[model samples]
Target: MSSSVTSPERKKIHPHKFTLWVAMGSIVMMFAGLTSAYVVKKSQSNWLEFPLPKVFWYSTAAILVSSLTIHLALKAFKARQMGRYKNLLTVTVVLGLLFSVLQWMGFGHLQQSGVQLFGVGSNPAASFLGIITGLHVLHVLGGVIALLVIFFRAFSSSRKTYSPVSIEIVSTYWHFVDILWIYLFIFLSVV
Candidate 1:
């Protein structure tokens, strides 16, 4: 009797998600260096201190809410509840936009409070704060774009497959940015 050939299926890595991970790893390393420098620079006598704006707290809340909505959206997608998924995704997108607005408001507050972002009057403390947070916003923007793509896809005719990979990957990223902001906020507030 001829034995049937058996071959195990190899797990295929999602290219977009794989690229995101690699990019995130680079981001983590970049932030690590920035924070390290921040710590070292904080010890310097010339390091000027500034209070973090209250609007940042608002942004934090908005981002946290977005995280929840995205999670719900993912569940909805997995359950094949397309309508609920669309609504949740829309809410998440709105929340993300709100978070960005709040962050901008916080930055404006910083400027109003005399924490300049550049040139002559700029302090190391404020500079580092702006740089780190701005970099994070760039990543968040990327996530927002990804979500928007997913959102549009959900509305398209081809959405019936309802695969959870893309949504889950973006959810991971959204939560990462949320947690990263919280960590930075606490770090700046304390140190």
Candidate 2:
């Protein structure tokens, strides 16, 4: 008697979602390298140690809140509650913008405190911190742009059907950047 072989089915991810995962992986590597360099540079003489700006705490709160709002937005989208989803998404976008503004303010505060971001006589620690945090802010801005795209598409009359894939992608990215910020904040604060 011949035995038949059975194979379990494999679930496929959306191409866009897969692409996003790949991009996020690259970002992780980049940040890891940057932080490693920071650690190595910290041990060298002439490194300046300063307290992180208070505004960073507020920015962290904004990002954390934005993550929750985006998560709820995704749930609402899946539940077909368009109104609630839109409202939540709007809040997430606002929070993202707020986070960016807070970061800028924090930089300003640092400058006021005599931490030169970049110049002929800038400390390596301040320069590294500025570079790392600036990169993170750019990623956050990218997420905000993605949110805006989804927000506009949802409001468009041409949108005839719900695309959970799009919402999922944006939500995942938003959560990623949020978590990334938290990690960086903790690293900077402790180290």
Candidate 3:
């Protein structure tokens, strides 16, 4: 008698995952460079000083709450709770939009607070804050787009199997952005 062993098939790396990770890594490096510059510029002499906008604190809270909503949506998808998943995803999207709008308002508030991005024509500190937050806002917009894509995909026929994976990936990306914003906010506000 001859016995044969069968090996289980390995899952291939989805192209979307690779692309998403590459995008995320690029974003990480972008912020890394911005924050490093911020630190270095903050140490320079005669830096123009200005108070952080209070709206940023509100934006931070909104992002944090959105993270929780996305997390719960992922959990609901895993548990096959479609209604809960949809509700949570909707809430997450709303929160994300609110965060973006608040960030824009925060920028306006900074302007009102007399925070100039250049000091007497040449201040690195002012430029640092403006550039860093602007870049962060751009990335957050990208994240919002990714979340919208996932939300639409969730309504398809294969929703049960594929929706969870998409939601998980989008949630991961969203949470990363949220955490990045929190870090930048703290660094800018306190350091």
TM-score of 2: 0.96
lDDT of 1 by residue, 1-191 (tens): 99999899899889988987898788888988999899999999989877888988889999999999999999998888889999999999888888888888889998988889878889888889889999888888888998899888888996577578889898989988888888888888887
Question: Can you write out model 3's per-residue Cα lDDT over 1-191, one digit (the tens) per residue?
Answer: 99998899898877777778898899889888888877777777877888788888899999999999999999988888888988888889889889999988987886676676655664677678878888888878888897788777676676446445567678888998998998898888788
Indicate the residue-level lDDT of 29 in model 2.
99
Pairs with backbone N, CA or C atoms under 3 Å apart (clashes), candidate 1? none
Q: How far is candidate 2 from the true structure (C-alpha RMSD, Å)?
A: 1.4
List the candidate numbers ranked by TM-score, top first.
Answer: 2, 1, 3
- Choose 2 or 3, whichever is better by TM-score: 2
Best by TM-score: 2
Q: Can you tell me which runs of candidate 2 are displaced by over 4 Å? A: 1-6
Q: Which segments of candidate 3 are over 4 A away from where they belong?
A: 1-13, 118-122, 155-163
Off by over 4 Å in 1: 1-12, 157-159
Cα lDDT of candidate 1 equals 0.88
Clashing pairs in 2: none
Q: How many residue pairs clash (N, CA or C atoms closer than 3 angstroms) in each of the candidate models, in the order given?
A: 0, 0, 0
Instruction: Assess every candidate by TM-score.
Output: 0.90, 0.96, 0.85
